[model samples]
Structures are given as structure tokens and as C-alpha cells.
Target: MPKVTMNINGRARSTEVENRTLLSTALREKLHLTGTHIGCDTSQCGACVVHVNGKAVKSCAVFAVELDGATIDTIEGQAAPDGSLNVIQQAFKDHHGLQCGFCTPGMVMSAAALLKDNPKPNEAEIRDYLEGNICRCTGYQGIVNAIMAASGQAVPAIAAE
Candidate 1:
């Protein structure tokens, strides 16, 4: 087993895992970060999306040992320190971007990452960028609206003190 060290949600963590262990498994099974869902074994579904080194990545496609010393952020890390919803989360709720809510976490994370790179994305850009994340419910309008709304709003900063 190979040992891996990662900063998850600003917390430094280390674990010895099998070489072939997927990041999703490491997050969910080992770290108990169930927010990163395993919707599909293949990388097609973006439910297991997580920020790796500040970029949104499909955790299922990455091996745990390969991410040693990387910074990872899951959906659970997106909320405000007081347990209040972040701007994106509030946008989703305000826009009704989620129906079943199974895909909302991934969608929110992906959108948040997208906004980090492109703060003012248009509708087409939002759709094009979010194509990787598949949502069975709420279609794409609500999600798009949520992202659009969140794009202009400032995200809540995580408290360090």
C-alpha cells in the first residue's frame, strides 16, 4: 500500500491506501467525506467532483496515491463557517437548481471552480463548461441560473481564526 498525504478542506490528512484505490473511495470510505458521491464507476458522471490543486477534478478517475501533497476540497468544505450556505448554495436554493439534490453538490463545486476562473460567464459558456456534470432533474436552466447568480456574488470566506 502506498501512503498518500493531502490537504482536504484545509485539513492536512495522511493515509496508507492501495495503489489502485480511487480518490472517491479514499474520500468517501476512508475520510468519510460522503459529499463527493460515486454516481458512476466511469468518469462520465461528475458526481464525484472535487477540487484538486484548486481545479475541479473527477475524483473517480484519479488514484488516491497519485494525489500526495495535493490540496483537495469537497462539497462539504464550501459552506460558511457558521454552517450557513455559501453564495452558490444559496443561489441553487433560490433558483431551484436542484430537484433530487443528488447532483447538486457536484454542480455547485463545478460552478464554483468555473467562477474562480471565469467570474462572469455567459449562458452558453456556463452550459459548455458544465457539460461534464450530468443532472437528471431540474434540467439545466435552474442550474445555469444559479451559476449566473452566483457568478456576480462574493463567495463566503472560510474562517481561519
Candidate 2:
């Protein structure tokens, strides 16, 4: 077993995990950060997305040992210290970006990464950036609107329907 240590959500966390332990598993089972869901172990679902060293990556595809000493940000960290929803999270709620809530954490994480790289992404750009995220509910209209609203852009009445 490898003892992996990571800076998760601005805190140093250490866990003893097997050689084949996936980052998602280490996060959920070891670190007890269950917000990073394991919707697909094959990495196609994008439900395990998290920020590894400031980049959005599907946690299911990465090994926990390989990321030892790296900085990781999960959905648990994407909020104000006072527990207030971050702009992106608030936007998601206001826009109804989630359905069933299985994919909400990853969607929010991906959206945060996109907004970081392209703060004012247009509709087409937002859609393009979200290619990896799979939202089975809300038909992605609310998700798109949430991202736009988070960027301080005007969200069209797309969520009004």
C-alpha cells in the first residue's frame, strides 16, 4: 500500500491506498469527500471531475498515488468558507442546472474550470467546453444558462420553459 498525501481543498490530507486505487476512490473512501461521484469508472461520464493542480480532470481515470503531493479541489471546496454557495453553484440552483443530482458536482466543477479559462465564453463556447460532462437531466439548457449566469453574462430565457 502506498501512503499518498495530497493538498485537497486547501487542506493537507493523507491516505493509505492500494497501488491501483483510483483518485476518485481515495477521495471518497479514504478522504471521505463523497462529492466526487463515480458515475462511470471508464471516464466517459465525466462524473468524477475534479481540479488536479488547477486543471479539471476526471478523477476516475487518475491514480491516487500518481497524484501524491498535488493540489486537488473537489466539489466540497467550491464554496465560500461560510458555506455560502459559490457563484457557479448559486447559478446552477437558480437556473435549475441539475436533475436527479447525480451529475451536478462534476458539472459544477467542469463549469468552474471553463469559467476560469474562458471567463466570458459564448453559448457555443460553453457547449463546446462541456463536451465531456454528461447531464441526463435538464437537457443542459439550465446548465448552459448557469454557466453563463455565473460569468455575469445575461442568461437568456432558456430556463423559462
Cα lDDT computed for each candidate against the true fold: 0.87, 0.92
Error of 2 at 96 (Å): 0.8
Runs with alpha carbons beyond 4 Å of true place in candidate 2: 159-161
lDDT for 37 in candidate 2 is 96
Clashing pairs in 2: none
Task: Please estimate how well model 2 matches the true structure, expressed as its whole-model Cα lDDT.
Answer: 0.92
Evaluate residue 104 in candidate 1 and report its C-alpha lDDT on the 0 to 100 scale: 82
| Candidate 2 lDDT over residue span 44-73, tens digit each | 888899999999999999999999889999
Q: Each model's TM-score?
A: 0.92, 0.96
Q: What is the per-residue lDDT of model 1 for residues 91-140, given as tens digits with 9 covering 90 to 100?
A: 99987789988888789899989999999987778888898899987357
Kindly give the stretch of ten consecutive residues in candidate 2 with the minimal lDDT sum: 152-161
Task: Give the distance in Å from residue 136's predicted Cα in candidate 2 to where it truly belongs.
Answer: 1.3
